[model samples]
Target: MDFMIAAAIAALLNIGLLGTIIVIYVQNTRLVQSYFTYGLITVASAFMVQNIVIVIFWFNLYTAGPAIKTIVDAAAPYLFVINLAQTVGLAVMVWINT
Candidate 1:
């Protein structure tokens, strides 16, 4: 698979993980009314937004000129790894929160 494709998949997964985390954190905040939980929800939400932006950027890059595409292609693998790592970390957070 193309590196961009892989990166996109990882980003999608990260988004899902962040969504799950946000849901859980929201529930926790409602129950405990703790500022810390609210902060967690905010951070997870920010991460989710970042992932959404990354996915949109990747989709736009698909139609970019060859020069830009080439540069993005070079960076895609690193991006994928970062996304994948975030996914794992978020998954762990979800697991812990539950």
Candidate 2:
């Protein structure tokens, strides 16, 4: 029960983050013309896709038992790497742009 609640909360927060990024992207498509900004956009897009996958997995986890959690745990490493790459890319983009 606790795990399900936590996963639900995380999904909600990630959705909010993705929505914010989309808003920013829409407001300034011009930024993506630059190489660094383009990279950021690409990584962010990938992160969004990963987030969607995570949400699906999390939803499944919520309904399923402890065994399903192993799948989610297995994905953690991949998610961590992608998230790290995205974070670094975001920092670089900000540094380069500003």
Model 2 collision count: 0
TM-score of each: 0.93, 0.54
True-vs-predicted CA distance for residue 10, candidate 1, Å: 0.7
| Full-model lDDT for every candidate | 0.88, 0.60
Going through the candidates in the order shown, the clash numbers are 0, 0
Candidate 2 lDDT over 1-98, as tens digits, reads: 34444554555555556556655665566744566666656766776787678768767764587777777666655555554455555545545544
Over 4 Å off, model 1: none
Q: What is the C-alpha RMSD of each candidate to the true structure, in Å?
A: 1.1, 5.3
Candidate 1 backbone collisions, by pair: none
